[model samples]
Target: MSNAPVYDIDPATFWADPYPDLARMRAQTPVCFVPQLGATLITRRDDIFVNEKNVDVFSSDQPQGLMTVLMGQNMMRKDGDDHMHERRAIFPTVSPKTVKNVWKAQFEAATARALDRLAGQDRADLVKDFAMEVSAEALKSITGLTNMDWREMDRVSQGMIDGCSNYAGDPAVTAHCDDCTASIDRHISERMGALRSDPDLSLIAVQTQAGLDEAQMRANVKLAISGGQNEPRDAIAGAAWALLTHPQWLRAARAGDISWLQVFEEYARWISPIGMSPRRIARDHDLNGIALKAEDRLFFMFGSGNRDETVFARPDIFDPSQDIAPAISFGAGPHFCAGAWASRCLIAEVALPMLFERFTDIALVGDAPFGGWAFRGPLSVPVRLR
Candidate 1:
């Protein structure tokens, strides 16, 4: 075992709010082993920013990791040329040009339709009612699984996400994840037949036309759904909660003092939707005076890094005035989120603006709750729509 300091934490407490413990870890031991997580956590901002790109030392190619085991080997679990190859294969669907020319209008229509549906309601759970609907519909267009309803898309995506993060080896979580992957496989199979006859620029269609085998196509699309559905879902709802709570900032944006893109960037920094990225220690090496062994589990704590006091002023506060260029919400490495541009377009350009425009008097109903550390977001944002 390495000589790194050991930090013990109550799993339940950490799950609810990891920032306090993460802050201590960053201040005391940047590289320490967390027994509960069964991985060495690198918690400092600069350390993760610099080391995440050092693929040779801290590698993403974890063959035995949970994501690969449950979700199959997606591009996120690969390194170097292998990762770029899969990324290029699906570029047609997620590329900035495609997102602008093709997806932008679709995202706008979806957001508008969702807003119309909620127009009659005076109160709603934004997470389930609004954010989930818009995120899933946009995702259906991107993944070419228009056959699956928005609810099923959200359900299966959450299942696979839970399965990937089931480090405790929960049998129920694993079983549900299996079912979700199976469901996704069936959807992909059904969609492939349609795409062959009438092709489109969706992830499944483009990958199939590019001659990627069935397994790769399934894995890659699953990968897209896993992050695509939840991250945007969370961000859309969470950002709304942030603005409603901080009316001053909301007023600034409404007055054109700040861009909605800035709000998204700041909120992403404050509470990262994708909080942690797990890695495997490819070879024996020392990181920040801590001895690490080959094949040992490691985690780049992006949530902690974003809140590192040395990097961002008022790191804990959700203030939009701060410079957010150092934020790694989309990650800072080879696996830097592939769907970032799409997410930005959906949430910042279409979802947030149109949402406030539709319901100008929107306000929180009671309390909006948040959970999870690995994948963090508002669990539910109860709001008064009228």
Candidate 2:
């Protein structure tokens, strides 16, 4: 084992604001091991972008990993052929063509319904009231869990996310995640009968038609809910907060000088919702002079990579006009987020513009403080909507 820098941090403080530590790591020891996290972090953009695709060395399959243990072995936990097979199966629901032809309208309707709910309110937390509602409603349609309440979708997603990230072995978090997975399994079972009789272009329906077993189906749905709900939810609210505070950009976007899609992309680059992805070293390897052993836990810090100084100009600032083509907010490997198109369409094409249009003037009541380095976004975007 090669000597790696032992970087110590107060987990609480790091969770609140990780950029400073990340930037420090990038400058000093980009491949240091954090004992608190029990994982080696790769902070540079180039390193992750290059190495992430090398799945032979940095594999995704980890049976003992938190996500696999807590949420079952979903495609995201698989590698190579296994991952691709699952990705292809679910592609019908999230493919760009499908998103444009089918889900976009559904997404618009969901956003509209969420906006209607906010019509009566003057002040509200966009995180819960608007963002969460819009994302959850659209997720229900996409996942074919229309029988499940929007709140229930959000609840289970959060539970699984917390459980997967529960590195401290919090039994309560693990138990909650177990409960969430159990609920998902029940929902999947309930919906399967109808889906077989009258199949549609939802994740569960498509995967079922593809002949995935019950365990796999449940895992995929749980995976979708885990990411599908929160990332877009956070992006919708986070991008709104970003553009609202940066009025010049918001005005430009509303005026059509800057595209809403551009704003979404930029905000995603700035504060990536799916921040760190955990990987297990599949074999002993040398990465940029740092020795990595087989089974050593590692994290590809997508958040830090998006803000790499060498790649992005003024990487810390959120600029819609800047070229974000290089950002790996959705990842760059075979395990890249399959719902990228759907998320973009939902947040940019539907949720953000519709919400702004519905309310004449939407302003922040106060600062909306953000939390979480792994899955980061505003805790509550308290805003006054007119």
Candidate 3:
């Protein structure tokens, strides 16, 4: 291990371009400790599968830290039966049936309206103007927070995710998280009263019916907003980036030679939005020959695992037609993303097709760089939409 290359997981470098560092880690030290993060970074695909699936050995119930701070005591932090109960309660909202029978048209309409707003503009930031707007609107529709401003809700969601990512300790991040939490609390309270007087088919109503207390309801709402908004938003922007940059794939997608769903999958594998997931070792164990003690923090590098050479041929290439394996972007095991169906529909069926239909030609106007070591995606994808 002495000969293993050392990589810094700092904000500046890691977020700038994590692939190279992640590649090195995967090659030399697939399970090595990073002093900066105070945890072992796991980079290989198989290793992450093992870690995510074996919840008994690597627990998701992290004790009152970054995740709990940002998301509260929600399903993301729960284990065993508690996690399943919380997940099942909210499953209907994000299930394939709900997405197909209910949310699909709404998602399409939201994307169409967002694209309509961008009609007059020669150039626009895809992330801000389109992707973020659609994601925020979708969350509003799903949670029945119609009165709340989508932009404000997005700001709160972003703050919670940013605080969780920069969990090492940043005063501004913490303050923003606190403010977001308060806002969520207020929204939850309002929704509770609304449910009593006039109920609707929303996630809040579902949770209320499940008999979850105030804190659990708020935490789960935060989790839904944060997970639902950011990952899918980034997925849209990332798919746009991939398609625009790789014209062949774009042409195939537009010409109906490839399924839009396949394009979305390839984009996710090529540029994972949520790059890493945090886990804690439940007890003393040996992982891929590396000794891990109890309470050891582990950062499962999903972004790296998706691009593992062993998993995908020419892993770096953005080829949607290749026989690509399923990526770990939405994660694995019982903790797999509940919003997966909705996210896929929003991106593949609604957002991507809408962008293509509205714009004759799309090209990057400036450096639309991808960042965020943990939650990765283009910060601003400035494009000329003709």
Candidate 4:
């Protein structure tokens, strides 16, 4: 409706403060064709996904932006039989039961160590000190890089995710992304080789034991890193910020004398790091009355969806007792974020306890500056603590 530069938008507007814009867009039209991205993005929760009948008109297999270059033919970017194959190979590693059993201890131990590091610190940037450290350790541990430096791992992973948002927008970014991808490939190949030769008690070993083809294993590792790297870590940091700011949520979460997982749902709703899932339609489609052609790029604004007035009461304000938290940060479709359960486990173990123990107080020191659009998160969370 308005001739605003929605496509070429700042990360802060969308990540730091996206509710108003999303409300304006969602209320006016759930699906409006954006010429810049050449696709209609569905903004409403109800009309967010196309039904089974119209599924053929809009396919998730056809990739866009950095995905086209990076994950051109990856399992997620493939359709039909190919997509199903990849999903099967990767599903066991990220399934909820697997995460709850196998990864939970490692995640909690890593979280405890990270929290100990900041036990008596006067003040700290949660993003730099706790969130990144905790997440990096858990992730590297899962990948069998137990001896890797957490900071170095953080640098590489954060660089890759942060680079994704600006890669297509700038020549320098595009070049840097090429370098990053090469490094990730090398790391994955080396790990794959290790799994191939000397088996260990790791997911890599599990994949190999499950009779995954060499190529499939390689692709699965890369896909796991790409989907679950900085995004989930940022979310962990965001979750801590939410708990610290809302003592009720933290107190309730810690008081497992009751149901705590419900509090996680609320905390996650407050600070969803992946504010939106960007996708490109594969064919011509009618999206909520809007005519969209093939290869149209759309952003499913999770930040907006979580706070939709039509969906939630008083969308802007945070509520720990929200009966429903409809956030699409993971995504919503056939390719709806395969690693959702593992990520939630990581956050549950890492962020919740750290907030409960270490920091007595956590508040926004100033205006929060967000990372790029693709990786939705605050770059820093300055807080005053005891």
Report the Cα RMSD per candidate: 0.8, 0.9, 2.0, 3.5
- Model 3 superposed RMSD (Cα): 2.0
Question: Model 3 lDDT vs. the true structure?
Answer: 0.83
lDDT (Cα, tens digit) per residue for candidate 4, span 236-309: 66666666676776677677643345555565555556665655666666554555666666666565566667
lDDT of 2 by residue, 54-104 (tens): 999999999999999888899999998899999999999999999999999
Can you give the TM-score per candidate against the true fold? 0.99, 0.99, 0.96, 0.85
Off by over 4 Å in 1: none
Those runs of model 3 whose alpha carbons end farther than 4 Å from true positions after fitting are 1-11
Candidates sorted on lDDT, descending = 1, 2, 3, 4
Report the lDDT tens digits of candidate 1 across residue range 1-386.
Answer: 56789999999999999999999999888899998999999998899999999999999999999999998999899999989988999999999999999999999999998999999998999999999999999999999999999999999999999999998999999999999999999988888888988989999999889888888988999999999999999999999999999999999988889999999999999999999999999999988678899989999999999999999888999888879899999999888999999999999999999999889999998888799999999999999987
Better of 1 and 4 by lDDT: 1
Relative to the true structure, candidate 1 has a C-alpha RMSD (angstroms) of: 0.8
Candidate 4: which stretches are off by over 4 Å? 1-16, 35-39, 50-55, 200-203, 210-216, 256-260, 325-327, 360-367, 371-373
Q: How many backbone clashes does candidate 2 have?
A: 0
Error at 66, model 1, angstroms = 0.6
Error of 2 at 266 (Å): 0.5
